[model samples]
Target: MIRTVVLDIGETLTRDDRYWASWGDWLGIPRHTLSALVGAVVVHGRDNADAIRLLRPDIDISAEYAAREAAGLGERLDETDLYEDVRPALAALRAAGVRVVIAGNQSARMGELLRALALPADLVVTSGEWGVAKPARAFFEHVLAVSECAAEATLYVGDHPVNDIHPARAAGLRTAHLRRGPWGHWWADDPAVRVAADWSINSLAELPDIVKAQE
Candidate 1:
């Protein structure tokens, strides 16, 4: 039985295209240029932080976030930013007595942001809190420990093919490749990565049915 479902934040639960574009503007880079950097990072199998460093060697990520927070831009996620299917899917899962967790490779304020947005999750976690990030075995192990459930009885949903799907599957959890964001649309045709996910979903509306089937 799939007792727990852990979700990725960026492209899976929330849409951040505009937010990233704003960040690009703040950094004096064209949004398209910043987007290209993001695509390049995924294509080259590089980490997002490494790509940011390559783009701006002098910028400290923490300081940048602090600046944004001071400007009342960071640490805020509005309900409109979420995908349309997210709330309904989460509600269904929760109503069915499944534990839902929002655990992602996010900053320290992720839990706060989720709470501020009033997202329906039983627990929220971040790499900053856990001291490890996704695509790492330790991160998935930590998730399993926190969920207090066996890996085989858990499901992880995310937009990344390599970072999210592959690692979670390797860690013995079922994975659903949510095909909506950059990673999903870009890597959708990659046969190797495509085969790694136990399921591929274009919408979170499809999730409850998938969970039901599992049960």
Candidate 2:
């Protein structure tokens, strides 16, 4: 009976179209160049961090993210930045007596940012807070422990097939692939990857129905 729904933040609940472009500007690279590099990384099945390291070997990722945050990169998020389906889906799930959690591979300020946006999540967890990132078994273990929910009774929804679906499925949690962001649209046709998810949804509007069906 899925008692908890764990959701990814970027490109899942929120649309961050300007995020990479802002990063490119900060790194002194052309936006298009950075975009192509990111696309290449996805195509080659490499981590996004690898692409940044390949482009700027001297760049310190942690420091860069710190600087970005200091400069207010992820600080303030407007309501329009969120997907139209996000609020409705969250409301429906909450009304159905399901615990909604927002968990993601983001900086420590992620929870604050979501709060600023007034996102409807019962709890928010981030990699920075947990000291581990996604695709890591320890992270999921932490989530399960914190939520106090059995793995089989949890559902994880995210856009990344590798980071979200595969790892969550391996952890015995049902996985939902949101087919809108880069990971979803780019890897949608890949049989090996897409097969990992229990559900593929283009919008969060479909999520409430899917969750009810799971029950």
Off by over 4 Å in 1: 71-73
Q: Tens digits of per-residue lDDT for model 1 on 79-195?
A: 888989989999999888889998998878866777677777898888988899888999999989877689988999998887899999999999998888778887876887778
lDDT of 2 by residue, 1-215 (tens): 88999998888988766777777888888988888888889888788877678789898988888788788664446787798999999999989888999988876776677777766778887887889999999989887876668998888999888888899899888888888777879877678767788888888888788878877
Clashing residue pairs for model 2: none
TM-score (all chains, Cα) for each model = 0.91, 0.92
Worst lDDT run of 10 residues, candidate 1, spans: 45-54
Please tell me which predicted candidate would have the highest lDDT against the true structure: 1
Q: Which stretches of candidate 2 lie above 4 Å from their native place?
A: 69-76
Quote model 2's TM-score.
0.92
